[model samples]
Target: MLESLSVPKRRVAAQFVLPGGSSRKVAVFLAEAVPGREGGERLSDLLNGSGPRFIPAHDAETDAMTFVHRENLALARVAAEHEPNVVDPFNLPTEHEVELRLVDGQALHGIIAYVLPEAHSRLTDYLNSAPPFFPLLEEGGQHVVLVNKHHVAYVETLRR
Candidate 1:
């Protein structure tokens, strides 16, 4: 019975800034590693594998979790019953369009990710943090651009 408890679950904490100036926190669980895998494999596996979970934050005053809950939930079902493949989220190049409104009164348009919630990154990785710069693909789809997160006022996902 003790063996069953050997697997470790990690608490993943994330804070996302809302469109309005408020921010919210989210917490979730992720297995530290597979039964017999290499070091740092847990995060990679969780991103590509079928299991990762969210425990909900201890302080639940608002619905800030609502904004990022979908992606978080999708990461946690655990294990692949069918195939054996792991996705390297850090390198994939798929993208989603989003609009960023800056505190300086400028609006920038671009694509935000290659993989949503990159490997080892909480699904909502960039929401509440200041970045060296958030790199993105510009709307013209020609140049790679970087935005300073400090100037980020709000974000809007422009579904295409």
Candidate 2:
């Protein structure tokens, strides 16, 4: 049996850039409270392995490494969950613009923005037309969104 874990209260925000070059912001509160295990298995799978690995790129002129592509996957998950109306890839605003107020007495907030349809297409293409990257959690016999910290616009961990 899994030991009862304390759900950490967290706040998140994000910004997305739409194809039209416009941006939108998203904010929310996340806690262990979302409900049953949603994307936990998938997340675990992604993190379980030796974490992320780095491989040298073939390009001699430029040097790059390959990892789990956590950023892209995380963004894709959020987009899949919210289906933001707009996404802006360039000139993203700072986290201060977006804020998430936690009702569980956990203070948190920030901003998240992404580049629109183009980004979506690229991500979807990679995910093989899978549902956006958002994870689902059981809440009152219904599924709800469980935001991940990696992609959140901003996160503040309060002092206990």
Question: Residues 1-160, candidate 2, lDDT per residue (tens digit)?
Answer: 3545654644333332222223334332244233454332232223223534321122222223222233333321233332222324454422112333222222223233233345554432422442333332222222223233334443332232
Q: What lDDT does candidate 1 reach at residue 48?
A: 32
Report lDDT (Cα) of residue 14, candidate 1: 40
Q: Residues 41-131, candidate 1, lDDT per residue (tens digit)?
A: 3222433344433233433465343423323221121122211223364566445588877675656687665343445343255444423
Give the candidate number with the greatest lDDT: 1
Off by over 4 Å in 2: 1-9, 38-126, 133-160
**Estimated TM-score for each candidate:** 0.37, 0.21
**Worst window of 10 by summed lDDT in candidate 1:** 74-83
In model 1, the runs with Cα more than 4 Å from the true position are: 1-94, 116-123, 128-130
Query: lDDT per model, in order?
Result: 0.46, 0.31
